[model samples]
Target: MAKKAAVLMLILFVASLLAGCWNRKELNELGIAVAAGVDMEEGGRYRLTVQVVDPGQVASQQGGNGGAPATLYTSEGDTIFEAARRITQISPRKIYFSHLRLFLIGESLAKRGIGQMLDLLSRDHEFRTDFYLVVTKGTTALGTLKIMTPLEPVPANKLFSSLETSEENWSPSLSVTLDELIDNLTSQGKHPVLTGLVITGDPQMGQTKKNIANIYTPTQLQYSGLAVFKKDKLIGWLDEKESRGYHQIHKGVKSSVVFIPCPEGGKVAVEYIRGKTNVKGKVVQGQPRIDIQVEIEGNIGAVGCKKLDITDTATIAKLEKEVEARIIDFVEETIDKAQTKYRVDIFGFGEVVRRADPKAWKAMKNNWDEEYFTHLPVAIRADFVIRRIGTISDSFLNQTKE
Candidate 1:
């Protein structure tokens, strides 16, 4: 009987110990974070900005007239953790970050190196690996969060939606999630790239505009260029033309248009619908040789030259060659500059080499960038097909000429 009593007491003791709760935080006691920004502050400290959405306001504004768009709150500390902890003192509730959509790292911070900031994010339990990591161009991280968007009730949503559309169109820039960036940073023969955003005009461009046409202008968002990186540091930015070339080489371009200047003092616009690139490599006499084949299908959207009859097979063939030549020029320019000027393997060419010849990669893996890319031989071939002309059978310009 005494033994039975002892067992019951032991069970009671264990249950009582487990039932005790400490440091329990209620949902109402915390402010949920949707977007976050990290920037460099004066005196070598970090400034952390957070966008928190009010649930009351969010619930009230369903389709239109949403609650106070989004509120921006900021804090500063010696370190990222310290800055985040300081947020609690000013904010009525603790900050929660389980639903973060985007993380913006300032230009200055990016140049200094994102390796350290990444360490803090990786250690945090609330940060999800799937959230996007973007670099701000020509602006501070806090400055980007200041603008309010007109279309989606919040500016951040507009920015996030632009990323989705970029994938559908032929844009060289790529969006990297926290997980993907970490993988590339840690992986061999692979480098990381992030989509870039620049804040142009004020958010309320057409809030009180008198002209009806001007109303739509303010609602639009502009996405331009990409930031090239060497490991974790920002190296340079690519122009729109260079970005197009990057997309072609990396097979990231979905659809875009090209305007070719004809000899007859006019232009022809070609809308590219489909494009594919294939790269093959071979080693000869201790030299690595690469061959690139790009196939493109497009339609002639506009023609200002009267001499060229696109309907005729010969004329179409000539036009196809001209388009192919233009693409080849851009591709070569991008490859040459990246190889000679930047000297970084931005096209993942090293990855191609690794996949094709694992034994060779293992042998030269230590200095692939130094030994292979510098003296690497690359051969390029391009094919462009004009699949269809516009809806009109004959050009208006041709009739005018006649």
Candidate 2:
């Protein structure tokens, strides 16, 4: 009887702890923000634009018939925090940022500095660091967000997917996350590079419902070149070729296409199979020098030259040498631009020096970027290998019979 009484008491205590939901929030009570854009307005204020998803429309099977997937709301204030709270005045539901996928900053705002905006994001509990960070080139961040995409009902989702795909396949642009940007801002001897986003057509038409009605949208968002920053402030931009070269030195290129001119009046396309870059810093006699070694392997993608024989081992050797030379040139050009034009160390060479020679790095850490990095000598060595020649060993263009 005593044991039975004890067991009953324990069961009653456990039952009391399993009460109703205390912190549960209804989905309808919150406005899910899929993307956020920040721009600078006149009078030293911030303009915040958020893309809030419509659950019913986003979840509907009959896509276009369900209305727009998201609606954009804008608010302006002296600070980002104030601007964010002001959004509640216009929005019916509470804005929630836990699901945000993209964060965009306008070119003008980026040039001014993004440290203030970054501070609020870092302190906010509702925001996550996984979302991609991008800069709107030649337009405001609000304009980029206004552009609607056809294939993906949600414009924010489209931007997120496009950024990932471009970074994986294309070499010109690089995606930077919130955490990575913060890291770059804090780290010494290195700067940050953000992928640029641009609106291609009429900005007004992109915000309308008719933007997604046709097979070809009037306005579209494009991933532009890389925006280079020095301590949270935008300094300059890198073109396609220079951006690719930066990727080569930074080991950002996963796989890309490289075209080399053939001996004949044609070109040979090679798909990058694999590439690795190693940067080492050395201090000799109080002088800094960086050695960059890159090893690349690729397969022949297309042969436009008819006279070039793919089966010949001599031809393959010559092509490999040519590829190596081209890679070296790319690295040199990028270093020159960084040294002479930007005068910023976006390559993280200071960190390399720090690790290699700590004592020497400590002495130069104070004025590394402005003094040492600008005049640092960089030596590039590239080795290339041709792994395969597509499906056939010999191209059909080879008319010479064995």
- For candidate 2, the lDDT comes to 0.89
Give me the displacement of residue 278 in model 2, in angstroms. Answer: 1.3
Question: Model 2 over residues 308-389: C-alpha lDDT tens digits?
Answer: 8888999989989888888888778888998999999998999888888999998999999889999998998988889999
Candidate with best TM-score: 2
Clashes of 2: 0
Name the top lDDT candidate: 2
Kindly provide the TM-score of model 1 when superposed on the true structure, using C-alpha atoms.
0.84
Backbone clashes in model 1: 0
> What is candidate 1's lDDT per residue for 65-167, written digit by digit as tens?
5336577789998899999999888888888888887888888888878887899898899898877888888777777776655655555676677776775
Query: Where is the poorest 10-residue window by lDDT in model 1?
Result: 206-215
Misplaced by over 4 Å in model 1 are 1-30, 55-67, 202-221
How well does each candidate superpose onto the true structure, as a TM-score? 0.84, 0.92
